[model samples]
Target: MKEDSFLKNSVLLTASNITTGILGFIFSIYLSKLIGPVGIGLYGLVMPIYNLFICLMTAGIIAAISKVSAIYKVKRQYNNISKTIKSVASFNVIWSIAIGIMVFFLAPYISKYGIHDMRTVNAIRITCPAMVFIALSNILKGYFFGVSKIVVPSFIDILEKAMRIITITLLIIFFKANSITALVTLAYLSLAIGELQSLILLFIYYKNLSKKTPSSADKPERASQLLFNVLIIALPLCINGFLGNLFGTASTLLVPRRLASAGFDASTALGMIGKFTGMALTIVTFPMIVIMSINSLIVPDLSETISRRDYYNASLRIKKVMKIAFLLGLATTVVCNLIPTSLGQMFYSRDDLGAYIKIASLSAPIFFTSSTMFGILNGLNKQSIILRNSLIVSAIEIVCLYIFIGIPGVNIMGYGITLFISSSISLFINLREVQKHIYLNLSKSNIIIFTLLSILIFMILRGLTTNILNNFITIRNIALILITFSIFIILSFFGIEED
Candidate 1:
């Protein structure tokens, strides 16, 4: 592949990712308003379990598909690529049915033991259809991404979001007159609709593929060996994903349980969890859209470099992505922290929720860094390393959330503390891994000077400016964001690019 071709592919993938991020972020605002904090908490509590189950059902086949597809495209083996897709898709279909059956029987148990809400049981049952849709959508997405066709996925993303917004908005109005059972049912229905729309768009795009077979240069190497190879790679990835999802779901279940043990009423405990854990984290998580976009674009390129044993190029790509990610993360953290309340009020008009936003602001950089690092590790076939690191952090977080919530006076803030500590630990592990593969070639003088300047600026403009900005919330917050970003960009101008 020529440099220009790679650049074009990267640009499309990145743009699609950015579009997904923006649309997904805006959609959250609607969701926050739809259910309020308490409702958001209920949804959050149920979602972790759903996501955990989904990850288990999918078995990390999505990453395996992308990895195998990249190899096949590089080798120009068109026939085997088709076989690989059919095999993975078949595997996904089988598990989807199996999991759906399991969830059908377990819904009552989940509702009774998990959140004690019958409405959530109905929601769990309604969400069963997403299993099949998500499995197909993810597998196809991996194949398209591997083959360097991102526009279809991008378009499907926008379509899915549109369906979600429309479905949820109409359903919110209709469900208002019904029970909580009706509301949760509507939410689940909207999720299934989005997944179906995405899968349909992908299927349509895939149908056009027979007209354009792979060129001679796109033929793949040994087909028989590739399946086993990809399966080997996918095993640890599956475990990593399952553990990660389980950690999240466990935290959700444990936090509220702990809160109740600390003497809060059921509603108050749920409300506090919903406010801090639900609203703040969900809204701030928009940056994930950006990170994921870049990750998708990077994976094929990373795999290509590794396959050819171009360690230098792989190191350069990793460094460049990390440096840029750090800058973006720092900028977002400063901006969000400075005006958390204003941003929260822009959507959900709740001061307490806004406070939770501020508490979570510092976590942006940690999450961004950790996510990208893991992506790089996955691309480099360092799957076991990622699994170990993730498991460590997940264990720490679960214990912290569980023990902290059992304390006498800890409330919703305990959740924030757990996230902060866990993310920070994960970031350290990722940084250590990055250093093992890529050396940071910066001069000590330049690094120290920039570090000092940033800290000084942050310290000088800390509380007073934010207090003053609160008086003129809208304009002042925007001004602060622009000014901070401009300064950061100016400082970054002096940094050297990774070779």
Candidate 2:
């Protein structure tokens, strides 16, 4: 890879990710309208189990492949790189298929006992195939990331998302599935189809690329050894992700049960969980769709910067990205706060979403900024720290949700409180570690200026969204968000230039 690997890959990935993220959110909104909240809640219930299974099966495949393949690439051992992917992919095929079989069989148990909703049985079973598909796709995705051929997987992901949207819509219409359970099950089936499409395309690309690349004639490593090489790197990451997701899945499953325990009926509980998690949380975290791409692609680049003791550059990059994260988060927060109803109505057509949206939006700034810390930690080679902090925070989340959601008064609102507290702690722990390594040299004056200017923008946004352009719900919401950020960026250029 060239010295400018990050720059080129970042640009390619940013465009791809932004496209896919926007589409994915649009798909979420579409699903919301098509299935309704209760359906979404049912869908949501099955997803965590699906995700946990996928994480357990394929969590570390990408990073491990990227690491091992990159090393082999640098050594000009193209054969070894190909062989490593073959080894890993082969194992994942058998591994994921076995896991999928288990999920299919255990769906009834999970739906009945774990989720406390037998309606989710079909959805859980439907999601099993997707776990296998994603498991294979991750291997190819990791290979692309390793060789810096980001465009392949990037393009494939966009296509996959598009396919998902089309497939789900078509399946529902074709089947005329009106029941929530049937609809949710079909959604997972669509996901499986899309993942399968993505995997097939990835394999095609891999084959073509391998055929063209010149191979070194050195003695090839055994398949088992090659698999070991990848697994050695992947195993720890797999454990970290699995454990973290274990906590995350628990937190997810607990919400509905906790609400039910608070005296809400099962339907009402699922509805609340759907409104908050599927709808409100998605709306609030919209900016992270782009910010997260930045976070993901920057790790290797930041790690390189840190390795060379280029603390100054590293700090500058951190400051720049964090500012973007903060500004985007702040802008999202303001828009959501001022016109939560407008946004809720515009996107979801639900007058009821305003309450959840308002509460969820409160975390936008803190959550988005903090979300980047994991990427920063990865750059700092603080893998163990990330694992530890994640486990600790997950523990905190479980405890908070347990206590808060059980209270009759707190109920759904507890989700918001838990989100705020967990994000704050994760931010604090990760940011402290970052500060110790690189003196961020953040400009206090700039922070103050930006904060003040944001207040002013909030007021302007308030007028524009609530009074002046309020009648045109879509335009008012969209234009106000765009214009607010436009002014902020222009003002920052003139008044708050950290550079």
Candidate 3:
């Protein structure tokens, strides 16, 4: 892809993510209010299982498709590209069907034994069919990413999210879902509607592309060979994803239990976990939508660069991306710290949202850095090292939660501390490994000094503004956000520059 194409695609994807993030944020706030903390807790409980199944069904085919398709496009092997997609799609369909069946049969046991909530059984079962649609949508998305036709996938993403929100909102209004079981079931069912819509859109796009593009006369690879190649690239990633998500799910599920052990009853513990995960963490990680979109757009470009042995350009790209990521991360962290309570109150109408936000904000820099580094490492084909790092940190995080979360007075705050520690370790491990392949021009002293200076300035300005505004929460929060954003922009212009 040309530089202009890369930039355009990145901007488009980022814009889409921002739009979707806003919608999702609003949806979450509404859902939280409607369902309350207990409902949010139940919703959160169901998601880990949903995500694990989705990951297994897709089996890393998305990345594999993007990588393989990009290589074939560069080589002008359109027929091979077609064959690859077909093989992957076939494999994914089979896997998705099998997984769906398993989920349908095991829903009762999973809800009862795995999550310890019989209320989730219907919701889990209702979500199983969506996995088939999700599998199909992902295959097409991967193909689009591979061919550098991101517009289709970006538009489809927005459409899917919109559909889900609209469907759920309508269902809630029409059925008056007052109970947790009804609301959760409706939410899961809406997911199926959204996935189905996405599948339809992608199918149309695929058919049109197939009709327009000329078929190559070149003999295609055997089906078994194509499947073998895809598995070779995808299996390791799938294992990494499965294991990582499994551990992540365990850690989250343990939160309410640990809270209960700390002194609270089951209901109160679930509510606390709900507030922490469903409210606080959601707001803290809002900016991640942009970062993750950029990462997705860059991975294919990075793969193409590596394929051409253009290490210098790749290094330049990595440095510029990392610098921008770090600045954004630091700026967001400072802003969150400055007005955590204001933001929490503004978004969730909860007095304690601020506390959880403050604790989670400490992980901002570490989380952002680790996430960006993971994408770069994947682009560089360092899957094994990434897997190892993920496993190690996940183990440490789980251990930390087990040991600290149940301690008296520790409670959910222990999860926050563990998040910071785990992300920091992962970031350092990734940075060290990344340096082996490319020289990173990270100005550690400058970043540290700038971050501290920015934080100090934000605190002083926010304090003065709050006093001047007579502690009007809304105005104060908006003023602080605008001021901090302005400062970040100014600093970017004067201090940070692309290499």
Candidate 4:
């Protein structure tokens, strides 16, 4: 592929990320307002398990869709793409029905143990439809993404967010004095509505594609082989997904219970967890939206290049991508950490959450870099390694949370320590995985360059936020910083090319 392909893909995906991130941040902020911190915490408490369900239902299918769709399209086997889609879609529907029923039946026990909110049982039940829609929607997105058709999915994402925002806003107005169960149910309804909109858009897109006559010669082989191939390709990815998301869910389940055990009331404990996980961490994750944008484009491209045996180009691109991700992550960490208090006041008006944001801010680089490594390994078919690394990290979190968090005197801070340790250990695993593929020899020159760049960014950001606090908080300040960063990236690009 030409460099133009990369530039175009990056820009489109970045735009998608920006739109989705804005929508997500806005939704979370307002949702927090609607439910209050305690309600939000209860919501957050259930998220990990909810997201775990989502992963189980849709994890491996996403990568499989992208991989198979791209490969089939390249080979002009349109029929194969259709066949794979049909099989996956069929599997998804059946799986959702089975899982949704099971969840509905077991909702009471699950809620009591996991979130201590009997209300979440209904929320879990309401969210069941998402299992089906999410799988199909990802299949659609993966197909378009693999074939490099980004516009539709981007539009779908924005539309989904819009619908969600509108629906949630209206529901909050009508149900302001409703019970916690109603509020929780309304939250899941918002998700169901959003998924419905995206699926409709995707169905239309699928319908509009011109049909072609498929050869009988390849039909049998294509139909019969896709299920096996997709399963084979998707299994490790499924495991990686399960392990990667388990900690988040486990933490959510553990936090409220632990806090309650430490003498905090149930509502207060839930509120604290929500403020930290929902409000603070949500804001801290904004920079990672851009990092994830890069990862979305990297996977299929890496897979394509590796298939063609272009190891040198693949390695160079991986390094460039990793460096860029690291820089963005580091800058975000330093800037956010420096102005945690100001940012908290400006955004959410809570000092506790602000402090939590500052502490979690430092994990940005490791989180972003490790995510990139997961994408690389997934592209290289090293799914087992990804799963192993995730399992190790998640196990550390589970053990730490049970031992420390459940101790008689532990509080919310235990969860924070767990986050730091789990993320740090995961980063090490990612680094080791990368070393197995390519040796990154950081000589004095590389170290000097990295250190100097870090110092320059930190000094600039810190000076603005500290010495010029008032000006730094202004919209103008943000615009200027973005403009300067844009210029710097442009100049650096040209300089690198020239060298």
CA lDDT, every prediction?
Answer: 0.74, 0.82, 0.83, 0.74
Q: Clashing residue pairs, candidate 1?
A: 75-219, 75-220, 76-218, 76-219, 76-220, 77-219, 77-220
lDDT of 3 by residue, 1-499 (tens): 4788888888888998888888888888988887889999999999988888887777577777788888878777788888887888888888899999999999999988889989999999988999899988887888888887878777888878877778998998898888989998898888888889889989899988977767777788887887787777778778888888899889888887888788999889888889888999998888888678877867788888887898888987787677667667777788888888778888999878888888888888778768897679878888788789889999999999988889978898897899899988988999899889877666667677777877788678766765565458888777777787677766665454334
lDDT (tens digit, per residue) of candidate 2 on 56-97 = 899867766776666677689998988888888899999989
lDDT of 1 by residue, 1-499 (tens): 5456656876776677767766766776677676666677787777887788788877557677778788777767777777777766776688788988899899999899876776688788877888778877887888887787777778788778767888887877776634555665687789988898889889888768845775454454454565566668777988888899888787788887788888988778877877776668766666566577767767677878877888777777776676556666677677777678777776567776666786777776666767787778878778899889999999999988887778866666676677778888988887687668656453446446655676676766675584584567767866777787687777666766544
TM-score of each: 0.90, 0.93, 0.95, 0.91
Off by over 4 Å in 3: 468-476, 493-499
Q: Candidate 4's error at 118, in angstroms?
A: 0.7
lDDT of 1: 0.74
Name the top TM-score candidate.
3
Estimate the overall C-alpha local distance difference test score of candidate 2: 0.82
Residues forming the 10-long window of minimal summed lDDT in candidate 1: 214-223
Sort the predicted structures by lDDT, highest score first.
3, 2, 1, 4
TM-score of 4: 0.91
Cα lDDT tens digits for candidate 4, 318-423 = 7777666666666666656666766666667566666777776777766766668877777877888888888888888888876666666556666667777787
